[model samples]
Target: MIRLVTLQSGIAQGLLWAILTIGVYITYRILDFADLTIEGTFPLGAAVTVVLINSGMNPFLATAVAMLAGPLAGLSTGILNTVFKIPGILSGILSMIALYSVNIRIMSDKATVAIAGNSIKKIVATLFPAGTVSNTLSTTVGIIVCAALIATLYWFFGTETGCAIRATGNNSKMSRSMGINTDMMTIIGLMLSNAIVALSGSLIAQFDYGSALVNMGQGTIVIGLASVIIGEVILIHKEHNFAYRLFSVVFGAIVYRTIISVVLTISGFKATDIKIITAIIVAIALSIPVFKEKAAMRKKRNLAMKEGK
Candidate 1:
């Protein structure tokens, strides 16, 4: 029963992170750039949301402010990369590094804040009244919100600007020739991606009944990347429907968390080994294509041997 609860908790955590992974996909996959600002921006959102909620601000409004902050972080990186001619990856690294201090300031140098007694939780308690049932309701509400946001994103990506963003990603030189401002497209793409990321952070802070802490975003990009790769692995031979691909990311995140929960339940491994496990999963996912090629070659060799016999 404890193991089952652990598994459920993992799934819940993963579902929350699925939003961040999808945000990462926008820049990493769609825009073809690394926007490491997500590391700082994610925790920034949480911090801002917690601070506002603690000061008696509206929860929804606080969440909105947090979401807005994420895009601005991306914009800073975008300008650094595009305007100053810095490499995209390097610009993102610089921005992320800068955000470390910014996040510290935002959190008022606290390592962690206990949001368990906050108004957000109180409001939910009032509504649900039941103990575990309130937690369930909060999770359900969050899932619904995430689902709606994902659907809206799917629709937006089908728009003209979104198509241009995709085109710029596929070939910036061609997009330039077509008179689309590739620089602007990059900025817009990063902005949108980080907005989603921050929104995820806000939801996480509120849901977990915790305040944002600096460095909370460590390994976040890797987790997101892992989710994407896991999703791809599952859909390796599946059709290329965009909606399916998007949902697969969410599914992958949940599965990844499920795996972690199972691992954590095993007494042999320390909780700190999560990063090691995450790296292993990512390495395996990345090696899949090479493995597939080797398998094909072996099959061909066997066919030749049969013919010779």
Candidate 2:
């Protein structure tokens, strides 16, 4: 019974974290750049939302405001990367380092701030009520929000500018030759990616943890990359469909969470072993493609030898 509950909780957590993974996908996969600002943006969104809510702002409006907070951070990275010619990863690191102090200020210089007041703390808490299984509501909300974002992204990415952004990621030089402004595309992509990432921070802070902690986003990049890699492994053949890829990312998070939950429940692995588990999962998932390619090459060599014989 406890295992069942744990599994259910894992699924819920996966659903929530999937938003962050999708956000990571925009820059990591879509734009083909590294942006570490998400580590700060995640908790930044949370801090902004919680502070605003505690100050008597409407939860919905406060959350919306938090969503906007991410793009500014992205914009900073964009300017640093595109204008100053700093590397993408370094630009992101600078923004992330700066956001740490910003987030601390937003949280009123506190380490953590708990959700307060009579307003709905969790986004879907009203639907679940106090005593019901929290996982069900979380799953439902996750499905709704993720599906909506995916659908919206599908339509947006099919447009001319979206195609240009995708092209820029594919080959910036070719995109430049084709008269697309690669720098602007990178900026837009970074902005869009961080926007989604910040929203995830807001939602996760409000929906799951019920508090905004300074270190909530610690090592988030690994988890996001892990989820993306896991999803790609399972849906390796669906690379052509953007929507399908996004769905895979969402599913990957769930699978990642489920694996962790199962291991902790059945094995002697403590909760603290999660980071190592994540690292192992990511490493194994990453090697799958290499392994496949080697196997294919060996098979081809064998066939060639047979023919020669």
To one decimal, what is the Cα RMSD in angstroms of model 1 from the true structure?
Answer: 2.0
Worst 10 residues of 2 by lDDT: 117-126
1-309, model 1: which lDDT tens digit per residue? Answer: 347677677678877888898898889889999778898888888888888877778888888999999998999999999999999888888888998888877777887754543545456666774666534654676577668877887888899888899999999999999999999999999999999899888878877646677767888888899998998788647567677778888888878887888888888999889999999999999899999999999999999999999
Query: In model 1, how large is the Cα lDDT of residue 246?
Result: 81
Work out how many backbone clashes candidate 2 has.
Answer: 0
- Which ranges of candidate 2 are over 4 A from the true structure? 118-123, 128-130, 298-309
Predicted candidate 2 versus true structure: per-residue lDDT over 1-309, tens digit per residue: 347788898888899899999989999998999789899999988999889999999888888888899999999999999999999999999999999999999998899999894334454666666876668877887888899989999998899999999999999999999999999999999888888888888878777888899999888988999999998888767436889899999999998888888888866789889999999998998898799999999999999999999
lDDT by candidate, in order shown: 0.83, 0.88
TM-scores for every candidate against the unseen true structure: 0.93, 0.93
Q: What is the lDDT of residue 38 in candidate 2?
A: 94
